[model samples]
Structures are given as structure tokens and as C-alpha cells.
Target: MTDAPLIDPFQRAVNYLRVSVTDRCDFRCVYCMAENMTFLPKKELLTLEELDRVCTNFVELGVEKLRITGGEPLVRRGIMTFFDSMSRHLESGALRELTLTTNGSQLERFADDLWAAGVRRVNISLDTINEAKFAEVTRWGRLPQVLRGIDAAQRVGMRVKINAVALKGFNESELFDLTEWCASRDMDLTWIEVMPMGDLGNEDRLDQYWSLKDLRARLAERYTVTDLSERSGGPARYVRLEETGQKIGFITPLTHNFCESCNRVRLTCTGELFMCLGQEDMYDLRPALRGSSDDTALKEAIRAAIALKPKGHDFDYSRQRPDGQMTRHMSHTGG
Candidate 1:
């Protein structure tokens, strides 16, 4: 009998994988996690070898692109070694692309090495241009450091993208300025709504959830917009500004809900396979991956997990956990 992979019940082809190497970050963002956050223990995290093996298995199952994320993937030790081993797959044509999402706190140190390794693109998360406002948002005073990281990343020949999470009464006033800055530098930029996740995710912040739909309308007022010809195989849709030749994208997960075209899944640092970001259903991949390295069991587990993927995320913000609160942090879920 011939062996062929089974598609999900929804018929969406899963071709992208987001791997969170760690849950510890150098900065504490107000919208992402609790102010006093406790990170995962070292033993609970997957080793570089296990990560490499699981990634190879995903490649065998048709996952072509991989994005490394974290509470700051760079903050995790030995990430460079991890990238080195994975780059061979890209070189051997086993993988098409490898990318990263970072706070840009450490980009100045690792960008050149990461480019030489295999990271084709880098998305730096920056919410504001003002120094004090940046500190207020990320709860850290590292904007200058982050800015240097962005410059270093571009200088290393890596394609750069700026990721901004639009929050009301915060950086919303700087939207026009942020767009102009990215456009002048010829970098692709994206704006996403702040997702309410975890027990730390308070309903009060829901007031800060600015819709990208409204932002798009504001954008159309000043620029001549057109559709982009390329697709990164992820959720964000791109529009090209005819005047500046810069491409801007909007990821409105809370407002527009791109679950209809969702073709991705997330693997947490501890090997939990998440089918939907907004749902609690997950397959503990660590169980199948432990000891002696059974590739067969891992593949079977992966197939089973894929079959059970929900058709879409039921983003009912009112849904509450047993503790009378929601409890999924974006950092733990790989953003």
C-alpha cells in the first residue's frame, strides 16, 4: 500500500510550523504576559537535538517553512547551535525557508551569524518610536538597542520586517509615522491586534484592542494601495503602496479572523502541538518524542493530532476557564 498524508478535516493544508524555543524573554510586554512572569524550567524545555529531529519529521510531512519564536528566542542559550544544525536542511533543499521573530534586543549580536546560518527573514517587534512610550509598552528601556539590532539585521543582507501591535491610546497616534519610517527604509511592516491570552490577560485591556480594519481604512486615505504578488504562506495579507513601493500587511486575528485560510500550527517549547491558538486543545508531543527517539510513534502522533484540528477558533471572548478567567499567554503559545 502506498503511504500518503491525510489532510485535516477542514481540508486546509498545513505547510508552516512555528517553533517556540523558549518562554523566557528579556523584556516584559504589558499586553503579552503578566507583569511578574515566571518562566518555564530548563528541564521542561526541548533540547536542540530533539527540536532538530521533530523539525525534520515535519519536513517529511510537507511542512516547508519554519519560524523560530520565543519570549525572545535569542535570550535562550544555544540557539545559534540550533540554527547551525537546521541550516543544513535548507542547504540540502529539504527546507525552503527559515525565519525568526525577535524583540531585536539581541539582533545586533546575532543577525550576521543568523543570516550566514539560514534565517532568510527577520521580523522585529517594535510598538513605538518614542523612547519613553517604548519603555511604557515593553516595560523596558531598550529602544536604542532594538533600533541598532534592526540596522544590523538589514546590514547583514537579511530581509527585515517590522511588527507592531496596535494598542488604543498607546501607539495608535504613531501609525502614520511608523508607516512612513518603514516605507522610507523600504521594509515590509505589519500591524496586529493585541490578543487577549492567559490569566494575566485582563478583560480591561480588551478596550485597547484596536481593529486593523479601521487602521486599513486610515491607510487608504493617504496612499495608493495595490495587492502584493507574493505570499509568505502565513496569515497576513499584503498591500503595496503604489507611491512609496513599500508593502504593508495587517494581521487582524481578533477582528478579521483569517482562520478560513489558516494553514499553520504551533509547537511549544516543551513539545505541545497546538492546532488553534485560541483553543485549549493540544497534543503533548513531548510524550511521543521522549526516550530512544521513535520516529514512527512521533509521525503517528502527528497524524492523529492533525486529524483532530478544529475547523476554526471559536473566538468567543466571553468564554471563561474553570478559574473564572482565561489562561493562555501569547509568549507560551509562541505569539
Candidate 2:
């Protein structure tokens, strides 16, 4: 092990990494996919073997948590096999957690094999529970399939979290309804505010952004919520149902940015390293791995990438998109 302390610029332990194995996704969600989008060429994306090498190096550098994400991770071929290779590292106790984030389109088909491959937690992106509205948002995904995936994941005893981006005019009204539904099943729910990463036509759409304070105000009218003293993964502000066993959270990047405590380094589909969600900086690791036998050089590149992480991001989406902000579609970047 490197034995280097995990503190970043803010002195917070940075140990978790979100790796986007592929940029290609099966569904075209409104937030991520442009109406007429062109995806990257096949040759431009990283191979599964490349992803495995990066994961191994990250573990060697004190990263214990690994979350596999993509436009949809399942869209990549031989994903279970990739996880199987990663499992050897996990089983040897080099990595503590192996998780995934998916749109749930193909989760049911892959969840069992994934769990068997050593993935213990899974996050499913299901914005709206309404079938018609879901179809409207996802454009190509069927709600039933998503729901079935969620059910299968839960039945398999995996850590299941439902991620919903609370859009202003679209699904904001369903916040409380979704919370209650989660309570019924003792599930975890994360309500994320929409960030203006790319374009969606309306600039003022961000003006309607709701903070965690706003969400708590609305939910307090029904159930009593108590804030948890212990902080868990990433920047999510968490609260537990006062009477029920459900845990509900809000990831309010727009109003209350949490970059100070961010412990993540996102790897893009083509093996580019993004230090922060809002910054456009990247270091090409694939070429280095291909050219150098210097493992130290590779780890140094990772360190340099971490050193360049922004303190936090400004959520002024109404203004022009930040210059050099190279964040791809949220799906592609593993939102």
C-alpha cells in the first residue's frame, strides 16, 4: 500500500472512485441525451481490460470503494466477466466495496450474476414512478422493466438505492409520494437537484432549483425526520424517518455544493480521468498504461489528477456553461 494519507485539498479522506466503464447507454433520458445525439466511436472507448488495470492501481493507492457506472453499465459486453476479474481483487481484501449504478433497463438479467461476481450494492436511477411520465423522461425505457430490476435487486439482498433527479416542473411533485413509497418497503431514496451540465433549452429551468432545506420543509409536514450524525459516501445530506425505518436524502449540488468533502475521482468511458464533476480537466491514463511499464508513473498521474481537484463547483447554470467544462452526457459520465 502507498501508506499516503487520504486527505485532499480540504484534508478529507479521498478513497472512493466512480469508474465509467463505457459511455454507451441503452436508454436516452431527457437530462443526459440530446434529442439528436452522436455517441463516441467504438475505438475511442476504453476496453474492459483497461478498466481492470485502472481498478487494480486505484486499490493499491488506498481506494477501497469502487462503483461501476456508465451511460448504462449493463450495455457493455462481458461486464460480469470484468466484475469477475475485479472480484479476485476484492476477495483478497484489497477492495472493501464493489457497487454499480444503472438505469435498470438490463439490471434484472445481470443482478444475480453481478452479486455472484462480488458486487454487493447497486444504485438504480428511477426518476418518476409514473409509467407514462417515466417513458416520457427516459424516451426509450419501459417502467415495468425498471421496476422489476429494482425488485430483483432487493430480493437478492443487495444494497438498493433509488436515485431520482427532482426536476422542477416534471417530477418535483412526486418527492413526498416517492418518500412514502420507499418507507413502505424500507428502501433508501436520494433526491438530486438537476444541474445544468449540458443543454436542455430553458436557462431559467435552474431558477426553480429546490435545496435540501426546501425538501425537508415539505416532508416534515408528514413524517418527522432526524438528521444522522454519521456521514456516509459522498456529499449526500441524510435524514432518517422519525418513526419508520426508511432513509431519505438530498444531493443538493445546486444550492449547497459539497465539493469540500468529495472523495471521488470519476474515470470516463475512454479512460480519461475527471477530478471533479464541474471541472473540464482530464489526464489520459489509457495511453500511459499502454506505453509505460512504470507503475509509479501511473500512480503519480492519479495523484496529480487528485491534486488538481477544484474546491467546489459554482451552480450558476442560468449563466453560460462554464468554459472547458468537458462533462459529457450525465449518462456517459455515470451521474
Candidate 3:
């Protein structure tokens, strides 16, 4: 076999990996976990050791950024221990950064260890600011706990960013409030357009996705916003506060597709490697992990999966139709 490493068809080098630790979550978010999901079969999940070993090999193959994701990463057992082990590499500079994307339900308990484990950045999913609305969106999850988690995460020295998924009829009015709160903390807030890939996901939600032009216009009427291009890997359009150093981002998945510069890959909790959110193609990494596949072979497999990455998502093409054709839910893929 040729020893040359593989790159995606777009020449995008795969350096970042988002690993889903579990397919289960504490909250039943309308756009993530379905209301009827009881439990995932244990047999399909990868053990902790297996996940770490894969991560180790991935790091050796030029993966520098690692983000722990899940239905809720904190919900996974021994996450702090995992962070402890992963942090050594980060501290040694073998890994450039370690981060987590969570719902912030259990962050208060794990935030300290996570920061000590070399985790410096955290993304918390907060869709609504209203307590009743939060409860309604998450089925029965407590908004206070989520808010407390955010505060705790900030206290632990992690750069906390609130991820708000803007749906048509839900959480739209709270956009300004979320941005203002983030500005006060000197942190960032990202507003992502709702994708039609979860339980509450459908063509209607995708259609209702607010456009970046519209969001910017609304914000401009109140505050003086300056556009910036400092972020290239992220999928959001960047903007900085005129006076404060705070930044805000808007991801327009419905009105615009960002696959041209997308540099991220997602690994499901069940061990499937997905190249794109809209595409169903995936490479099963469980066998490779179980069989002790070498780095060269593993790299090839990952590249093959990326080669299949769609040119772009079909949300804009199906703007009018409710493309109820998503392969996996966001909770399963660690939204």
C-alpha cells in the first residue's frame, strides 16, 4: 500500500475529531433526543479504553484538536478520568486543544476536573432563556441546572460559548438576550440554524431557520457590530462588538451551505465515522479498533469516508419540501 497519507477531495486536511462518548442524554431536547427513546443497546457502544486508544492513534496521525461530544458528554462515566488522561498529551503539546460540547446539565459537577484535564474550551447548548420555554423544549429538564452548569463552567476557567439553535417559532425572541449575556461575560455566542435531523426536526423547522442577513440586520439596529474574519475552521460568520472585546457568530445552514470550508468530522457514539451531517455514509471504526488496525490502514479508511463527503447539504435545495431523510438524530451524533 502507498504510504502517502490521505486528504479529503477538497484538500481539507483532517486534523479535528469530535468523538461522541454516548448516544444517551439526560434531556429530551426537541431537536435532539426523541421523546420515546428509551435506551441504546449496550453492545453497540465502544468501551472507554477503546475510545482512548483510537484517540491516541488519531493524535499520532496529525489530529491535534479533540472535542468530546455526545447526547451529553458529561453523562458518560469517568469523563473526568478520560480528560485527565487526555490532558497529559495536551499539556505536553502533543495535542493542541481539548474541548467538550455538552448540554450543561452536569457541568457543575465535572467542570473543575475538565479544566484540570486540559480542557480549555466548552460549548453549551442553550436554546432558550425562559425557564418555562426551556422546560418545554427539553421535555422536562431543569433550566436552572443548565444555567448553573454554564456559570460553573465559566468559573472553572473554560472559555464558555453558548450554542443556540434558532428555530422558527421557538427561541427567536431570546436571541438578543443570549448575545447580551455572552457579551457581559466577554465570551461568545453562536446561533445555528435548525437542521431537519432530530425528533422536532422537519422541513418546517428548516424553513423557519433565520437567515444571517436577517439576524445581523436586527442586531445592527441596536448595536454597532464590526465584521471579522479571524475564524476559518468554524462554520459561522464572525462579528465583534464595537466597544467590548466579545464576539458573536451566526451559522446560516439553511440559507447558505458551508461545506466548502468545513474541516470537521463526527464520530457517533456507536463508533460510526460520519463525514457530513446530511450524508448517510459512514465508516464503522469499531472493527478497526477491535482488530488493532495500524495507523496507515485507519487513515485510509477515514479518508475513504471523507471522499464520500457530499459537496454540500441539501437543506437549501429542499427549502420548500420537508426532507424527512436524516440518517441519525443530533443526540446520537453529539450535536
Candidate 4:
């Protein structure tokens, strides 16, 4: 076995891996999935043990950061066991970080266990703070429940970051409100531009599209925004708010492309590897995972897939239409 690092064709070292544990989510966010979502059968999904094995292989291949994501990861049964298993790598200093992106629905129940498993930081998805608007956006989510969960996470000493999707007509009014809320709580805030993913029968992507360029300009009207050069191993470009002394991040996929320094890959629950988020190109690893009793074949398959990583994604909204729209829901790929 060669002890070589995982580097993509673009010469970018692949040190970050985001694994989607399940496609099923408790909340049907209007922008993420349909209200009536049909999820993958449980039998088809990889077992928790298989997920740990795949992730361990990546860690061995020089992947230092592992982010567990899902429609909402905490909802998955026996998920803590996987976290416990991965903590061994962290203890050994082989993995630098083990964090997750959640909707903050179940943090009240699992916050202690997550902290015990060595998770220090978390990213919570929240678009609005208004109760009525939150219900309308999440469809089945309760604003109070999520807020309580956030409180629980903080109580357990977890550093929480809020991730909000910048929707034009939906969250345009709450821009300063959300920013102030995060700043007051001492939590970092990142605003993401909506990408053209999935199909909603009535919800139009163009109507929902909100460029971060304009969002930043609006923020500049009230605050002194200064661009920062540091990255947090993700696509968000950050800026510091001088008055509030807080860091605000912008993920502008449409108006600006941040793919030149791409160093991450996503793994689905069913053992599929997506080389690029915007591209349909994928390599199935179930055969290698299930066929061998050893890790040789599985590692080879991962290396081969990484070699095919593309230069960048094609997400454009300048044509007055959702160009390069993906048929797969964002929930399916992992938010």
C-alpha cells in the first residue's frame, strides 16, 4: 500500500470529506425538497458500520477533516455510534476535525453525546428568525424547537455557526436581524446563495435566487465590511464587520466562482462519490466496499474517483433562467 495523499487532477489536496448519512429529513424546506418527498429505501442505504469503514479509509488517505451531513444527521438512528467510532481517529491525531452541519432540530437530545464524541464546532442551517416565516419556509419545522436546540448545543460548550441561504423575497428583510442575532450570540454567520438544485412543482429557482454580491453591498450600507484572506476549509469567502467585531461569510456560487481552491468531495449514504457537487459525474463504491474483506480495493476506487475531479461547477443565473440545474434534490446530495 502506497502511503500517498489524495490529490485531485487540479493539484488540489483532498483533505476534506462530507458524508451524507441519510437522504431523509424531518423538515421539508421549500428550497431544498418537495413537501411530499420520496426518500431512498432503507435497505438500499449503507449500514452505519459501512459508513465508518469508508470514512476511516479516507482518513488514512490524508483526509484530515470529516463533516457529517444529511437532510439532518442527528435524526438518523445509531448515528452517535459512528461518531464514537470516528473519535478514535481524532484521538490518534490522524484526523484534524470531526464536525457536522445540521438543521438544529435534535441538538437538545444529542448535544452531550456529540461533545463527548469530540465535536467542538457545528453549523446550523437557519434562514429566518421570525416564527411565522420559519414555519412557512421549513414547512414542517418549528422555529422554537430549533431555537431550543441551538440553546442546548451552546449549553454543552459547542461553538455554533449559523448558515442561512440568502433568498431574495423570503429573507431579504431579515438580513440585519439575522446578522445581529448571530453577532449577539457570538456565533459566526455565513450566507449562501441558492443554487439551482432539485425540482419543486411550483417553486421557481429564479424567483428564489439572491446573489451574495448584492447582499454584501446591502450589508455594507450599515456596517464597515472588510474582506479577509483566511478560509475555513469550505467555499465561503469571509469578511469582518468592524463595528460588531464579527466574521460574516459569503458563499456566492452564481455571482462569483470559488472553485479554484476546491479541496473537498461528497459521499452519499449509498456509497456513491460525487466528484463535483454541480456535476452528475459519480463513481459507485458499494462493490469495492462490499466485495472485499480488506481496504485495498476500496482505497483504489476512491483514488480513481479523485483523479476525475473537475475544475469547477457550472451554476449560472445570469441568463434569466436556472442554467445547469440539477435534477437531484439538495437533500439527496446532503446540505
Candidate 5:
């Protein structure tokens, strides 16, 4: 391994990596995927051992934070084995953090194992608290099951953060309610603007484009919102509510592009590395990984991919249409 850090063409040190362990998810979230989704064949996905090798190479190349993502990462069979494998990096202090983004449906069963494997924090996607509305949003998810999962995560001393999509008319009304719920539990909440990803048969991306600018304005009406300089190594910009002492995050990809400070890259289940979320440019690392026992080619492939990282994404919602939309679903790239 080289003694140098992985710096992109723009001089940004790439230290964070998000890897999708599987493209298969239990819930069919309306925004994330089509109602009748076609998942990837199991054979195409990188095995747990292969994922560990790829991630280990990344860490050796100066990657500090590794986040496991998926259609729903916890749903993968023997997923805990991957988490256990990554824990060695955490123990050696080479990796700063090893966490995952989940749908909270499987946390009830795996929360304890996750905590034991050095995962201290988790990002759970919860769009709404209303049982009926939750069902409507997730299409196949039950509120009680997810709530139980959340409880289990918290019970195991894991810090839980809620990630809610800011849907125009769907979740706009529940903003304050969600805020209060998270604040009461001492969990931070982040509101994300819907991105124009894969085509949903009956779901229109244009209609769902809710700007975080407008969402923040609505939040200011109820609480004293003050911007914070803190960044969690992701795209979300944060604010602190003085009234409740709660931290709120806004991920405004369309309204406010975060590509200028991009320090992370996403790896798909099949070994495709996406440098930008909204762009279609990607480099396949599978050939390098599978071609040899030595990681020389794999590391070179990652460096070459990082060199091609674009300055920013082209997600534009100003033309009254979903411009710069990718052909793949958000779930395909690990959401």
C-alpha cells in the first residue's frame, strides 16, 4: 500500500466510503424503488468476504470512515459477519467509524450484534410516524415493526438518527411532529429533498420535489433555527434549535448542491464505484478484485475513479421537470 492519501483531481482528500452490501430490500419504499421492483441476481453481488477485502483496501488507502448501506443493509443474510470483519479496522484505529444506514425493520434482531461489532451510531429512515401514512410511504412496511426496531437500537445504547424525506404534500404536515418525536428521544433528525432517480411507475418525481429551503423556512416559524458549522462527513448541513436544543439537518441536493465539499464515494453491490450521486459516471472494480489475489489492480482502479470525480452533480428541478435524472433507482446505488 502507498503511504499517500487518496486525493481527488480537485485536491479533496477522499476518506469516506459508502458500500452497498446488497441491492435487495424487504420494504418497497415508494420514493426509493418501484412498487414491483426487480432486484439483482444474488450471484452478481460481491460476497461478504469480497466486500471485506474491497473495504479493507479502501481503509488501507487512507479511508477513515466506512458506512454500510443497501436497499436495506440489515436484511442481508449473515450480514453481521461483514460487520464483524470490519470491526478489526475499528479496533486497530485505522478506521474512525463503521456504521450503517438502515430502514429499522431488522434492528430488533440485529441491534445487539451491531453494537457488539463496534457500531455506535446508526441512521434510520423513518418518513412518518403515522401508521397509515407510514404504510402509504413505505408501501409494504408496518409502523409497529419499525418502532420496535428503533426501541431495540436505543436500548442497546446505540445513537439513533432519523432521516426523513421532505415530500411536498406527503410529509410536510408531519415536520413538527417528527421533530418533536426525535427531540424527545434525544435523536437528531435530518430532512432530505427528494432526488430525481429511477422512474417510479405511478410516482412522479416532479410532484415530489420538496425543496429543503422551504422546509427550513417552515421550521424557523416554530423554532429558533441557527446554522452550525459542524458537518458529519456527509451532504447534510446542520442547524441547532435553541428552543429544544435539538440538532436538525437538511440535505438539499437540488436546492443547494453539496458537491463542492464531496469527500466520499459510493460502491454498489456489484463493485461499481459512483463518484457522484446524480451522475451516471462509474468505474467497475470487480474485474480488478476478481482478477487477482493481489490488491494492486483494485487500489489503482479506485484511484483512477477518484481522479474522474466531477466537481458537482447536475440535479436540477428548476425547469419544472426532473432534469439530470439517472436511469437507476436510488436503491441501486445504496440510497
Candidate 6:
């Protein structure tokens, strides 16, 4: 179908792929989605067999890491079976790691099953630790439920990482307390700067954007910050926490872009390929996936699409409209 999928147009070797399994989410986060919205129909989503084939094609072309995402991956019916199918790739040595990103709404009930299905790493979206504040931020979320889910995931020995969005007016005050709590638990914690992506439901969301640089400066007052020589091979540049097994990282697309070393590609639940998260470039593959069972066809399509990957997002918030603001919302693209 094509040559090795290692090198893209910019000579960046792609080794990571984030696949969105579904677009339906339970929570209505102010930043992710609006309160009233219609989700894609189930018939439009790629079947498990189709996803397996897509993921397999990527693995065949030097992609060693697979992270399954969703509006909330757990809410997708028959997801456990899907994990069982993906687990085979891990067992066969086709994929080096299998991880998930979730809102932690259903983690308590599915954590044990996830471990059995071969997932050892997970990222949970939690913006606040205070119960009342959590409720206000998530619209209808219960902090206890999410915390229980995190506990369940930990009990199963899964590597847990908490992803908290830094909200200027809401969670900034709690950042230190949350960091201390997570560090005490020996869990890796990352704070993502709130971004203005897509036509978010809440018009005032952009107003809530917080700078990760400020957070880092504040933490530097108490803890020793040292750059990690190596990280988990993700976009974040991790720094080891002083005197603790935990690490603190920041994903600052606005302040410090990581696109120069970007190697990640995304596949939406509906079979659309997004070469860059903050760009509007998208290619639909549902026809290729459901048309023929020929694996080579899909591989060729993937290669052709990625060949035109952008060098960087070039996102400047001060501009009239950032490229990311024109792209699909983060949830629609995948978590």
C-alpha cells in the first residue's frame, strides 16, 4: 500500500495515535460541550472490528502506542469487548502500551474490568477537588463518584494520571492543595491551560483561560523543579517533584508549544483523521473502513493523509481567530 509510515512530510516519525471510540459524554463541562447538544448517531460510529483494523494498520507501520479516548470511553456500550479485542494486539506485541482517557464518571464500575482487559495506564479529567466547586464546574458531576473511580483504578495497580484544567476564576486557588494531595498519593499530575477551542457552548469560556506559566512560577516557591531528562513520550515535559515519586507536568499549547516535536495523530470515532489537534485539517475514512475488508486500502489512505501533516498549529490567541478555534471542540476530536 505504501512505504513505512515512519516519516511524515516534516520528517517527524509518528509513533502515537489517539483513537476516539465515541462522541457521547455524560458530563456537560463548560469548556468541553454545551448543555444542549445532539450527539452522533450510533450507526455513524465505526464498529469495533473496524477500529481494530484501523489500530492494527497503525501498529503495522511503527506506531507502538495506542490511547483510546471518547466523549467518555466508558459510556460506549460493548466497550469492554472492544478492549478485549485491543488487548490481543498488546499480547501479540504489536502495541507496546494501551491507555485510556476518561472523565472518571464510570471508572469505579469499570476499573477492574479495564485492568483485566490489559489497560495499565489511565488519565482522569478532574478540574477541582472541592465537592461544591466540582459540582459547579461539571454542571451535574459528583466529586465522590469521580474520586471513587480514581481509587478503583489505583487499586487495580493501573498507572493513574490526573489531568486538571487550570481555570483562572475557579480552580486557580485550589491548584496547590490539589497538587499536594496528588503528590502525597504518589500519582502523576498534570495541569492543562484552559484553551478556547471550537465554538464552545459557553461563550465566556475563553475568559476563564489560565496560564500554566503562572502555575509553575507559584509552585516553584515551595518545591524544587527540575526538568526530567526523559518523560513518558507524550506531549507534556515532565519535571520530577522534589522528594516524591510523583511528577508535575504542564501542557501549555498557548505559552509553550510542543509542535516542533509533535508525533501524535488522531482518529475520531466516525473515522475522520486529524493530523493536528489544533488544525481544521480532517480526512474521512468511514467509506474505506466499511467498504472493503482489505487492510492495505486503509493503510494506504492513512499514509496519504498523514503525508500532508502540518508543521505546527501557529495558534496566536491575540489574532482574530486561532486555527484551533475553528476546529472541532476537544471532545469531538477526542479527549
User: All candidates' lDDT scores?
Assistant: 0.84, 0.79, 0.77, 0.93, 0.92, 0.84
Which model, 1 or 4, shows the larger TM-score? 4
Query: lDDT of model 6 at residue 190?
Result: 92
TM-score of each model, in listed order: 0.94, 0.92, 0.92, 0.99, 0.98, 0.95
Higher lDDT: candidate 3 or 6? 6
Which pairs clash in model 1?
198-328
Model 5 segments more than 4 A misplaced:
1-3
Write the residue-wise lDDT of candidate 1 on 94-138 in tens digits.
Answer: 689999999999999998889989897999999998999998888
Q: In candidate 6, which residue pairs get closer than 3 Å at backbone N, Cα or C atoms, i.e. clash?
A: none
Tens digit per residue, CA lDDT, model 4, 1-335: 55499999989999999999999889999999999999999999999999999999999999999999998998899999999999999999999999999999999899999999999999999999999999999999999989999999999999999999999899999999999999999999999999889888898889888888899999999999999999986798999999899999998888888899989999999999998899899999999999997999999999999999999988888889888889999987796
Worst 10 residues of 4 by lDDT: 1-10
Model 1 alpha-carbon drift over 4 Å, by segment: 1-6, 201-203, 316-326
Worst 10 residues of 1 by lDDT: 317-326
C-alpha positional error of residue 335 in candidate 1 after TM-score superposition, expressed in Å: 0.5
RMSD of each: 2.6, 2.4, 2.3, 0.8, 0.9, 1.7
Estimate, for each residue in 59-145, the C-alpha lDDT of model 5 and write its tens digit: 999999999999999889999999999999999999999998999999999999999999999999999999999999898999999
- Candidate 3 clash pair list: none
Global local distance difference test of model 4: 0.93
Which runs in model 6 stand beyond 4 Å of their true positions?
1-3, 243-245, 318-324
Task: Rank candidates, TM-score, best first.
Answer: 4, 5, 6, 1, 2, 3
**Per-residue lDDT over 215-323 for candidate 6, one digit per residue giving the tens place of the 0 to 100 score:** 8888888788888877566668788767665788898888788888888899999999999887888888777777788877787788877887899886666553444
lDDT of 2 by residue, 85-200 (tens): 99987899979999999998887898789889888888889888889999888888899998889888888888888888877777778887788777776679988877666664
